[model samples]
Target: MTTEKLVSEIRKKHSFLCVGLDVDLDKIPSFLLNEEDPIFSFNKAIIDATHQFAVAYKPNTAFYEAYGIQGWKSLEKTIKYLNENYPEVFTIADAKRGDIGNTSSRYAKAFFEDLGFDSVTVAPYMGKDSVEPFLNFKDKHTILLALTSNEGAFDFQTKKVEDDEVYKHVLKTSKNWKNSENLMYVIGATKAEYLAEVRNIVPKSFLLVPGVGAQGGSLTEVCKYGMAENIGLLINSSRGIIYASQEANFAEVAAKQAEKMQLEMKTILDGIH
Candidate 1:
């Protein structure tokens, strides 16, 4: 999907919510375990239930990788289902894959062409050579890790290299990359305070924000600082929404959780208008 189409979905749905499909079999309802492909079955239910309230869905690669080949198949099925049924909803492969130039090209193909994801989370630590390959695919986005929500982010991301923080340099330097317009960023909701500085670097770039709900990051604070004119934030909630219940009504409960966030997002969007 194009960036404009993504924004259109947000406007149509009154949401910028990205439901994280970081499904763990152990955490899912016991009943689903009996299904032939439990991971895909669980994902289908959640997608059906929550698609209306979400503009995007992100499946972290680790969850599926844990189950080996079967897990990879489930991930494939999940994306295929979304592509055929809910094409309007943006799909993200939350696979933080990055390496040397040639290797990164294959990674891009795996997610963008083979798996059919609209975007993929990429680690920019390897520099432009590693990231430019992903940007070569038109309409596909490479969401670079900027400032993350994890506590460990303090170790290197925030350190001052010269006069500015390391992440600031990332934002500034990445803007000049080939096809930089296709670049989005991952800024954790917990680091809302640094948003103004980030915006100054790339005023209209979209942000894939994790660390809401379960991580105790305030939605209000994130929007207060991070929101752009085009509503460039995809706030993710995984455990808090998808695992709201492990009973038969799990999908319905997940929808309710999504609705709660969408309603809050509606209020924020209304305020913006």
Candidate 2:
């Protein structure tokens, strides 16, 4: 999907919420195991229940990769279902993949062509060469990791490189890469304080923010500093929504969790308007 379309969906839905489909089999209700494909079954329910309240859905690749071939199949089914049923909902493959130029191209093809995700998260450690390959794909976004939500982010991201933080450099320098307009970023809501600096560096670029509910990141603080004129924030809530309940009524409970976030987002958007 184009960035314009994504922005339109956010406006139409009155939300910038991105539901994280980070499905953990152990955490899901055991009843789903009886289904032919438990992972896909679980994801379908979540998507059906929450799609109305969200403009995006992100499925972290590690969760599926851990389950091997079956996991991959489940992921394929999940994406196919989304593309076929809810094309307006932006899809993100939270793969965090980056490699040599040639390999990165393959990764881009896998997510953008084969699986048909609208965007994929990428790591920036390898520099421009690793990231440009993914950015080269037209209409497909490469969301680079900037300031993450994890505690380890301080190990390098916040480290001063000359006068500015390293992640600031990543944000600034990445703009010069090929097809940089297609670049988005991952700025953890836990690092909300850094968002003002982030916006100053790339005012229009979209930010895929994780670490809200489950990680206790303040949604209001993130919006106060991070929100752009276009509302360029995809606030993702995974465990907090998807695992709201593990009972038979899991999907219903998930919908309520998603609705809660969407209502908050609508209020924020209203204030922005």
lDDT of 1 by residue, 1-273 (tens): 899999999999999999999999899999999899999999999999999999999999999999999999999999999999999999999999999999999999999999999999999899999999999999999999999999999999999988889999999999999999999999988878888788889889999999988887899988988899898899999998999999999999999999999999999999989
How well is each residue in 1-273 modelled by candidate 2, as lDDT tens digits? 899999999999999999999999899999999999999999999999999999999999999999999999999999999999999999999999999999999999999999999999999999999999898888999999999999999999999998888999999999999899999999999877889989999999999999997898999999999999888999999999999999999999999999999999999999978
Candidate 1 local accuracy as lDDT? 0.94
Each model's C-alpha lDDT? Answer: 0.94, 0.95
How well does candidate 2 match the true structure in TM-score terms?
A: 0.99
Worst 10 residues of 1 by lDDT: 189-198
Q: Work out the TM-score per prediction.
A: 0.99, 0.99
Q: List the residue pairs that clash in candidate 1.
A: none
Give model 1's TM-score versus the native structure: 0.99
The list of candidate 1 runs beyond 4 A from truth reads none
